[model samples]
Target chain A: MLKIKVKLVDGKISKKEMVLNKKEVTVQDILDILEINRETVLIRKKNELITEEEILDNGDEIEILRVISGG
Target chain B: MDKSPKCSRCGKKAIIDIRYREEKLCRRCFLKFFEKRVHRNIEKNKMIKPGDRVAVALSGGKDSTLTLYILKEMLNKVKCELFAVTVDEGIKGYRDKAIEFAKRNTKELDLTHIIVSFKEIFGYTLNEIVEKNKVLRGARGPCTFCGVFRRRALNILSRELKASKVATGHNLDDESQTYLMNFFRGDIESSLKMNCDESISELFVKRIKPLSTTPEREIAAYALVKGIPFHMDECPYAQEGMRNVVRVHMNKIESTFAGSRENFYYFMNEIIKHLKTKEKMKFKLSSCILCGEPSSKEICKVCELLKIIRG
Candidate 1:
């Protein structure tokens, strides 16, 4: 099992720990697991900003931020 | 990646790492930096004057919400008053929620909030327009109708509110995308002449973009950090294919090249400045025959689109 910490920046969710059955997961997979819209949020891991294709490792701390686009 | 980086200003744990500048910033420092940059943009451009009533084109999105919040803080030092004008395009699920957020934000800030709807002004909601145009003319996508009408609505509302300047939340990304989109479409003239300076037409409000220099990501982060409530829902008709392609390409380039976005922005500004000096690009404005608003063409885009919808 992989232990990862996820923090939601939009105040929708509190910082929590997610135990994953896989050792690695893509950012989209995490969004799917959390039921967050892909286009609505950006993912960041540690000090680096991440894209949907970025892979996460065990014990990683990820931050999901809601993005606003021009109307 | 450095798991823990110190803020460049102070040794506090940094919340964000700005790779473009090779600096890390904590939440407090980041907010300070953001506000300072916004103030600099406004001051350098002379966007607002003392005793000027500035109307913020608030859409209840993160960018517009942050624009209103920062402008309110910055304008407090001056004698200007801030008001929010929200346009309800009559988007069923999306706009309804956003207007609610806009109302809440404006009420909390103690600013006068005005809501204008397409149904009241144009005699048809966006949905109705789309529905009618689909059968009549297979109307150009919803964005085409929405953008033209929304702009006119904002201008009219600003005038009615007696606002001297209208501020929008367009950030660096939006501007850059638009610039590139026009470039790609071979419509360099539109990009060059687009909002380079305030309009002389009395019907058009002097528009300002306080967040023009800020990136959309930074605006989003600031909105979240400041606890500003904004609806994150995107418009259902926002799938403008070419613009989206340009946006993604620009984001990819910016990610790889760091300051590429700002470089493009500055490059475009220089070109616009050079063009402005080379020739006087002026349009003789005429009142729209139908609505009596300022228009370069005889009928104006709003009247033209309305004709299509009503027919």
Candidate 2:
């Protein structure tokens, strides 16, 4: 199991910890597991921006920054 | 088997794969690609020119911050005077934090920053207006009020400052969503003004969106990569807007259909060319009797909203 800390950096700053059973998980997989829209956010790990296909390691501290401003 | 894509330009580890452009770019190459695209958009659209005084609508968000930073880079090439205008709608915790970010960016760039508030202009903060408006059920969402007032506030200040253009941080996602929303709502007539290079009215300043061709996620990524400080905190009242519904759907459509957003924009842009030539499509612009601001009706939306809030 992989221990991942997901941070949502938007109007409300909140964190969700996920313990995944998969041996390999991409950022897209994390977004899928978290049910986050890939179009509306940029994912980051270790303060570096990452792409959707970037694989996640155990104990990854991931930040999701919402890019949507309004309607 | 390493499935990771490398930079198509330099063969370095790619930070992003722009599927729409069929290019995988590293951090260094991506920045160049982004700025070059933005510069090209501004030039192709004739959004800016030498000796132009531009007022940037800086909300301290990722989009606006990227717009400001990019325009700041154009000081030499474009030879334009730039200033930042931030609308403080008085959302307490939310807007206050954003204003600090706005101030910091302007200070760092040595640019003028002006903050206009709902309290000062309308005698009631957005929070206060929402509180008072609670008496009437389904009166309106905070966005309706904020959008009308903020646009008015930005317009009034930009014109007063003698700016040639008001540069907003509206990225491709926003424009594409708007294009789709208007289409879905059958409000094509309202968007007819979009293709007009001419100022609709002297009272209404020309608005330029250099980032309108760029996607929102890419802007956020650029900001993050460049270490640009921005307050990405969502406005608490944001979810109440109708655009929230469309944005979700638009994002879904774009993700499923890569390049769909840009295609929508281009299609809409071309459609407007044919539509604008129709006699029935033209709307005459006139000044609001009460405030002497440009309006199609006797009263502008700002004054009308103020009347309701004041009452």
Candidate 3:
């Protein structure tokens, strides 16, 4: 098994040594691993919103944004 | 069930009936006082006129929908041509629900509705634009996208519908929240712009918020009374840190003071008046370089967004 680390640059949180067979994974799996709530968070892959079922390949930058409220 | 017998805002026994079946406000004192405040503000500003084509910017939210309902009823007393325009940002499940409710309410009210979609005209929804634009996250807020496009879309549609002036559902709570936010941010000029005075900039379509005198609780009650189809679930994005903090702070202040809403209006008014004297709040109007619409800069916000995304 190959090991890959997940890093959230904006929030400065890092996860190290995650095992994966392939170079790609689904967005939902990623969120599950990160323990983020999809309903409260908006994930953008390649600048477009990605549903949980969609797949993300290696080198694909992702953004996890918390929805802003108020005026 | 003996209903919850208290005012949501003050936590006192609702001495009035602000909403039927709900312990909103009492009839004798609070109701009369609140309604009279609205009437006084309307009369002082002279917001409505006979034979004027008033295009209401309805968002299917409690505020805008209630604005339409009240303005329509107000027009019965003073005859005016009232219609509604809704700009669909094409936010998939979110905006589609709003447009449906807006359309349904307009039909029920016997008012004309004009629906415009970003996809139909601009070849992209907000979803599409966000997908394409690299500078979306840190560079611009959601309002930067929604507010910019929606303003132009509403103005263009209203002009096509031959509206003399445009009306929005900006209520006192909304205005007060904005004022507090601006004051904290130290954005004096932007705060001045948020002022809902009668004579607005004439470069684009003139906009007014007649409900600026009405509280959010009152508007929500009015919407419920009219049976308007409004979405109550707050948007998912509403929990963003900075704005949510501000909202919580304002809510605390509002609860502490009975006339907090009215005070916000007067405070902003004083700021606007002072800014105007110093020429700091004087609006600069120029034709949009692309669309020839009235704008502060050579290019309008819509054109700027298009250029940024299309590039």
Candidate 4:
């Protein structure tokens, strides 16, 4: 199981600890599990912004930031 | 497992990781950085003056909310007046909520909020226009109508308000996407000439995008951290057109190559600068036949679109 902490930056939800029964997980997997739009959020692992296909290791701390489009 | 890093500046627990710069910043440091960058952008471009009355195009989205917030703070230091103008395109479910957020922000900031609607300005809402222009369908999408009318409304309102400058929340991602879209369409001249030759007509309000250097994600993070009230909802009509295609491609390119968006933005700026220096394409401005607004052609784009919608 991979243990990860996910923080929602939009303030809609509190930070939560999530565990997945996988050796490694992609950002899209987490977003899918959370039912969040892939285009709307940026996923960051540790101190680096990761793409949807970037794999996350065990005990990773991730931040999800909503993408803001201009008027 | 890698440990979460502290802010590079303050050593606080970092909330954002700026991949392009390889920097981790806490909420406070990030806000400072964001505001400072916006201030620099304004100063570098000479976008605002000490006594300039700037009109902010507030859509109550994360971008415009942060734009108004940052500009308000910066203008406070310079003793400038700011007015918030919102152009309601009359998108049913989307615009009403955004206008509420815009109203709330304007009230909190104590700035004058002017709300203009498509119905008020063009005699038809976007929905009506879209419904009427069924034959013109794919040739020009609803976004074209909305963008042209909304811009005309903002310009008209800005002049009516006697504002010196119009500030928008166009960030790096938006700039890059626009640049790429124009480039793909072989319409780079129009894109470059937009800001380069705005002084050709006094009727056109000088637009200042202070957040052009900042990325969209950073603006979102800043908005959240600063507690700026904004809705995440997008325009219901936004899913169509070349912009959406370009946006997806731009995002994909940005994700694959870090700093690509900023690089593209700077590259576009450099090209614009070069074009301005090389050939100052003087466009003869004439009054639109239908409306008295200044236009390069016989009729302004808004009026041209209105003709189709009114048919």
Runs of candidate 3 with Cα error greater than 4 angstroms are A1-71, B1-24, B27-34, B134-138, B184-186, B196-203
Put down candidate 4 lDDT per residue, A1-71, tens digits, no spaces. 99988998662556999989987787779988987655457666654455565567778788887663321
lDDT measured at residue B286 in model 1 versus the true structure, 0 to 100? 70
List, residue by residue over A1-71, the lDDT tens digit for candidate 3: 33444444332344354566775676667767776543334445444333455455555566554331232
Tens digits of per-residue lDDT for model 3, B1-311: 32324554565444333322233453234545555766676668778788889999988887788778778878868888999988888887777878878988899899989888888767888877766764544466555676678787887788778788799988776677778777888877567666545345454576778788776655544443334568655554446435566666655565445566567778787867887777555765668889777676788778888877777
Kindly give the number of clashing pairs for every candidate. Answer: 0, 1, 10, 0
lDDT per residue, candidate 1, B139-242, as tens digits?
Answer: 38888888889999999999999999989999988888888888878876677556657475777788899998998878877776677888886678776546
Interface RMSD for model 3 amounts to: 16.4
TM-scores of chain A in all candidate models: 0.83, 0.89, 0.60, 0.83
Off by over 4 Å in 1: A5-63, A66-71, B1-3, B137-139
lDDT of all the models against the reference?
0.80, 0.85, 0.66, 0.78
CAPRI tier of model 3: incorrect
Q: Order of all candidates by TM-score, from best down to worst?
A: 2, 4, 1, 3
Two-way TM-score contest, 2 vs 4, winner: 2
| Candidate 3, DockQ score (0 to 1) | 0.04
Every candidate's chain B TM-score: 0.94, 0.95, 0.83, 0.94
Q: Candidate 2 on B220-263: residue-level lDDT in tens?
A: 88988888999977888988888888888888887788889899
- Residue A63 lDDT in model 4? 85
TM-score of chain B of 1: 0.94
lDDT of 4 by residue, B1-311 (tens): 43445788987766666767878787778878887888888888888778989999999888888888888777657888888999998888889989999999999989899999989988888888888787556368888888888889999999999999889988887788888888888886567655653575778888888888988877776766666778886677777767887777666676567778788888788878777665554454678878889787888887787777766
